[model samples]
Target: MTVSVATSSRDMIEGALARAVQFPRLRYMGSKYKLLPHLARAFADVDGATALDAFAGSGVVSYLLKAQGYQVTSNDFLNFPSAITRATVVNQTVKLTAAEVDTICGEPADDRDFIRRTFDGLYFTAADREFLDSAWSHIDLLKGHKQAIAISALVLAAARKQPRGVFTFTDLRYDDGRRDLHLPLRDHFRERVEDYNRVVFNSGQTCQTRSGDVFDLPAKSYDLVYLDPPYAPPRDDNDYIKRYHFLEGLSVYWRGQKLMENTKTKKLEKKYTPFSYKRTIVDALSRTFEQFKDSTIVLSYSSNAIPDAGTIKDLLGAVKSDIEVREIDHKYSFGTHSTAQRRDVSEYIFIAR
Candidate 1:
């Protein structure tokens, strides 16, 4: 039975991707949304009834796999990305109603600007801070995947408003005269919610999301296990948790949570992960490959990142036969300003089956 890919669901995905906002227009440090077409082509012949997106950042890769009729198990360490996974991958057709959006924005039971009080003068404007404080507080009004969708929309709104799409530093300083900061952030939140709602369609699969360390979860046989771990920086710790801590706070609704001070950001303590350490990259990659050795593995990495493509292929080759390395000229999320540096970097996709 040849099922046509030209159905209404396919058209919705095509239209959303073609739009200016892009599908799931999420702002993350190392998202592979733009590289999905290449990834799809790379895994074209590898038939799989199920796929496990081991490091499912932004849930775009998992959503793409679900769109292609694969039962996807999207996993992320962060609660924010897990919310995105729930909304997009797990919940196939549920979307927020206008009334629900109204409640989420208008009445959140926040008497004080919780965001302002906690992150005073750090990230957003005073008004924007109040909006977030109220919005996230009321996110619990809805239940199940709808709440996750709303909270994920809030994460998107916060990231879009933040300069550079990272929460490492306060972008909305009084002197930093950026135009994006001047807009009404609440409006952006509503717009993002509606956009996400519009893009929702049934992928017709019992897709799901798992939140926590990939190793902590029980290993299951998957046709293809996609891994796109946080890139190991050359020096210093650059974990995703540190970069997007604000989203983490929002996802969990930072209330009564003990926050330790981080010297780098001076906002909140950064969660430590071994995968982001230069000394542990080889060992971490080796363990990950061994854990998923029973399944076909596809790893996404950057040419400029630590361990390089040669080292990664060597690691995977030990556990799986038929290792293949492919590269596409790519630009970094932060290193796009200098033409020379941008031209030099390449995105590497390593396939081991």
Candidate 2:
């Protein structure tokens, strides 16, 4: 029989506020922001005051756990999400005040900026590029979560200006009159900062952010470990690095970054991650389970992804005594293009103890 964990008073408060508190509006494709309610229900029985969010993409899961009174340690290989996690989860009380926002915005824009030199007409407007350089300069000077909050706002602004809410190559064939392409950069940025600043609250615990491979985390026993790695699509590329590499560059301030040659997309040159590939997924899952076997594991995966649920259960079975899978009906964050494929899908949560 499947036994679920009980929710605390903090959990009840957070669950109610989860609907009220708006998360940073990110355009990431596979974000679990919409599924937080279902996820909270699935893991309600897990024994944990502390959690390690192994693949904290978009940081919604980590932030939610933090709100529910968990001491969350959020890790993602990319710098962008790590910044968000640091700002929202790890941050106990630091928030960007209204006066600070004005100071950050009033910083001088450099024409010969790194973004202008590197990304001319690639992802953003020349003006937008210049503003970003100025924003980065001021943001880099600040320490800790203050910097994180500003950076998060900038990231959100950049993503909003891009088509399809991602950094993929845009077709300029019929680009005669696109209003969104010409939206005012600074105004949008200010609005984004205001939006992010409004949501800053004390999660009641000091969290942490780590950016690197999942295996490299400090060997310590967490009460629970949540994994939400990239899904291996059947016929399309779901590689997040390729999708959000621009944001990564922006997070790192594009210092001495390597760019892909002969490609219009201008994605950053990145090393291959096994979780982004189909053939290596089983090995990745097995290794992760083995590495964190000391803690209760909660894995979020799609019903129609690589390795299949049975394979995953078998892999988890080797590491833990009990395994339970919960299936929640869900839909894609972005609409499906194929007429043959339905928009509806099932999201599976594998719980192991």
Candidate 3:
């Protein structure tokens, strides 16, 4: 079925698009970047002044909601994505200055060699690893959102430098001769800083961010809550931490994170989340739905994921009587299969009130 956009909401969406131009879009897996138009249409008629992006993976949805005039709260279990949301969504006026960027990219004050030692030959080159070491030292010196902005840029730069923008495998085997893969990590960091800075604007609403389990979120009322949980695909390839451990480590500079030294990639010990596993996903979904039952719910899922569309609808039906499902044809940019094997799938948006 077609979802119509309210005229006022359409105007807000146009404003959102204009603001989004400067946002340094990530080639992040499962990002809603491509489906934003569909999401905007789904959100257009939803009655909400306050919204929660519960699984704010790339923070784009929270930014969209912000542009549409919602006081948004973006949350993610991963620190790296949380840093991105902090830089763009929660942060209102803070922008990294030219001096700050130079300081971040400049030589380190002390010899800190964590990335250099632990990840010597894993994801980035020796020079890039050394640059990351220096950048991490300076990034920690900045306070609050400025630090977050720097971390966000660093994470983006690292991802851009990597082939397919994932840390699942080492070496340049998947290199596609993209310009981003050739640029120095430092250059990528500087460019990303500018791009992120340009996207920073006052949404005229006090937005915030949360970094923790979805269940840990305080029982609070919002006009709406948007959920885009990690889809439990038939295969076990939706392990975001397994794919993004390096970026996650970069976000926190590996502090308090246990590195699985025996692994070839030197990834961090996997963080626990009920949503990523088949055994716990149904209970997780039920809990999430019931926890925010007072708010209008907008859930994003994939046809390739577990608990299929009909099952999800029934789950939501138990909580709210009125429900609508909208589907958009989509193809993911990155997958574990060949291009020919990567089939088109329906991205489903379940709206309930």
Candidate 4:
């Protein structure tokens, strides 16, 4: 069944974005959110197409596909990436009452439990920690698809109350004295069902969820393979996946683990692919493209990290009969301005047939 696309719902847009004031999700130095509209325009040829976001960070692109009423299949090895997908792209309509929000977020709970201890000395005010301490526990008792949906909502709420200041890209809330919750995630979920009711009520679905490398995608299974792998380099002598505490945190949130304090070391299982090395990067992408075979291949790459636009074009042309290159013009949302104040970025879209 087709879920009605309600892009014009202003209330949901307001409620859903309560957390947007902070670290909402799937964001990095080089994210695809700014390019989302352009990406959608480029894919104008695609309708009712089953879409896949292989590297579903923040699930923004996947959510975009979902918002467009496409059958979106999002897969990301990272924990937070998948969580955002479950919350925004593949969530169920939640029937919530204002009383439920109060019980879930406004009340007090034990702050010295394992979950609270996990975030000790971090940025979450005592009230924030207690809220999550109770809320996550409540969400955890449920099972199956409902679990994903509940946790998605709960995490958005809990992450806001965290000491780390709602949506910061930085590590901890009080680690370096930055304790302001940039975006109040709790405020977003406080309204819960009413926030994005019109949009999220229809619910979204995905094909699979696996904890594995991007190169492990099955052969000849998907119609389009969307790749949004990491653009950051690994820390000195550490694996790239190991540095993925952000992802693990989201996974833990899925399990209803409330992290009240930032810690010396992030706790979770980290997965990494051989993406930093040039040969490995090419080989892995080549294999992924090969597995899809003839499927319209659309890639999201940054001008700063991935191969030059020309190299990508040549590679795609060699792999498919047709190649379409769209230089997603730099806009206010995607950075790369003529001004000298903020960081600049340029992204490219390569379409292969």
Candidate 5:
């Protein structure tokens, strides 16, 4: 199943490594931004030229693989994250121009008051809601990678402006007086556009992005597959759509989505994912490992999760004989205090082949 690549020169590999660091930082939950160095080192020994990031939450791991010159495929069920990978990973040279940015941030041509009517005083200010409705109208006019870039910027802007970068709550209870909260949504959009643009670089490899259930992907073989599924913690929940429903709706302009009118936050109904529930997680992991058994697999799990590190190793061992585990002490920035008073936990990496 290993895809052979032409031998890369030392200079070429170094150049790729250098470009990997240019990826922009995100305030996303469960992001692997701080562990990039650890991930890079773990992947240093991989001899493959093709890799699949099965659950590219923040797309940082996919960007890392692409920078290492692996023809990377980044997949996420969430449209906002998929848009991010589309803008950065799949999009090599396409960038949104100043005129395009201005157009997207300008007034709407028609009286589209969807956000204003649907979300008045719920998430953002009145002016911000008007701007969002206007920007989404202009964003729809863009095509291909340009549209993806705009969506990515818009989503990032909304996340940054929201207190704690999530939509699970409407109040500023957890407000830490951060600078991102004070910034206007439109200003954040403009700044994020520049950040995404600066991260765009030619990796000289054809990368791709997919938005769907992981099992729905075509049965394509890659030399390496990285798995970082949502950790179903022993306590609390990992419902991403609940925390990001606004961004998800905005990603597709709520075309086919129906808001749950009974919900306090006006959030959409939660999408079903086996990885998020303790009852289905073990089976889900087993199936995932068995599906990609032909490829070298690297899994990231947490100490506090439902299926412990030993259970994960056992699951991987069932597919591959050779196995190795690496442990790193990592502290999460966001989590429910009800789970544990301390945020510190051990991050586990399991390599199976």
Candidate 6:
């Protein structure tokens, strides 16, 4: 049977992104943080359901589902996403006090000054370097949920305030030429901190964000698994996630404060053999779906095509006897942009029984 979950809450917001803490400065395409309401409406009948949000990008969909009271198992391959997903969907509770917020905002400016005072030869600005160092040093005083919320807010603020707009991933830093961009330090930090405070005080959802490959998840453990993996293929000669290396670092840190570079991966995959031409993704995913042979499966895709809508249905149809399809008009055209990608976003919602 197919169920849509659109139940309501008053002015309720998702945890991490609502605080703008997760992405910090990432402006990547197809981030679903803003698509929650639409997705909520789309999956409205999914009340009291169990879900396994596989890709868990921003955990927006997962958070919304949990907000609507779905039993959610949110997972991601990246650390920042895993941290964000957990901070928002799982550990989200209304536990911060006004005193904590006051303390966070009121940390001695002297600490920041000390950290930044040493910012002679560095990537970020003097103020930014100072704030980051100060923030990290003071983290122990932040308690449990407050620490997560503050860090989220701090990262978000740092990202927006960064002149180069780079937060996690650093390809190669230039000593000069960074001055071409200027983000006002004070206003940006305050905005991010405020957002951090708000999200900590607002969210209440039961969720978990784990860092691991999608294919590794236990089969049939989730009532639903929303997949939005990278469409770009990865191989010795294919293109893939290049600007997202910082995400790897973040996940490593979150799993228990370890910072180690992945020297194992020597180069980027520069080209993609078509999905049909290569059965790797489908093979692994299909194996996963077999475990969910009795659960609902929702797949979201776009056509820089991995498995287009029709093809996906055929794959999913192998498991469920009853399947329903709904397509949302994801309008991408915005006016007055010299370099805005206006690709059509036709999200196919497949509900299988």
Top model by lDDT, which number?
3
* TM-scores of the candidates in the order shown: 0.88, 0.90, 0.95, 0.71, 0.94, 0.69
Candidates sorted by lDDT, descending order? Answer: 3, 5, 2, 1, 4, 6
Worst 10 residues of 6 by lDDT: 232-241
In candidate 6, stretches whose alpha carbon ends up further than 4 angstroms from where it belongs are 1-26, 95-123, 140-143, 162-189, 200-205, 233-241, 247-279, 331-340
Which 10-residue window of candidate 1 scores lowest in summed lDDT?
334-343
Q: What is the C-alpha lDDT of each candidate?
A: 0.75, 0.77, 0.85, 0.53, 0.85, 0.52
Q: List the residue pairs that clash in candidate 3.
A: none
For model 2, how does the per-residue alpha-carbon lDDT over 1-353 read when each residue is reduced to its tens digit? 21213456555756634632587768677788777876776555676678899999888888777766677899998888998888877777787987877777786643338787778777666778788888777787789889988888888787777775666665543234556556766767788777776666786666899998998999999888999988877667676767777888888886666778567887888757887788898899899999999999999988767878888899999999899898889876332233425468888899999
Runs in model 5 deviating more than 4 A are 1-18, 333-342
Worst 10 residues of 5 by lDDT: 333-342
The better candidate by lDDT, 4 or 6, is: 4
lDDT (10s digit) by residue, model 3, range 43-153: 777876788999998889998888777888999898888899899988999999999898888889689998899887787889999999999888878899999889999
Q: Where's the lowest-lDDT run of ten residues in candidate 2?
A: 333-342
Clashing residue pairs in candidate 5, if any? none
lDDT of 5 by residue, 279-318 (tens): 9999999999999999889888889888998899989989
Off by over 4 Å in 2: 1-21, 107-112, 171-182, 333-342
Candidate 4, residues 91-181, lDDT tens digits: the string is: 6554444565565555444333544566554445554545556666655555554455555565544443344322333345334433324
For TM-score, the strongest prediction is 3
Error of 5 at 52 (Å): 0.6
Model 2: per-residue Cα lDDT at residue 280: 94
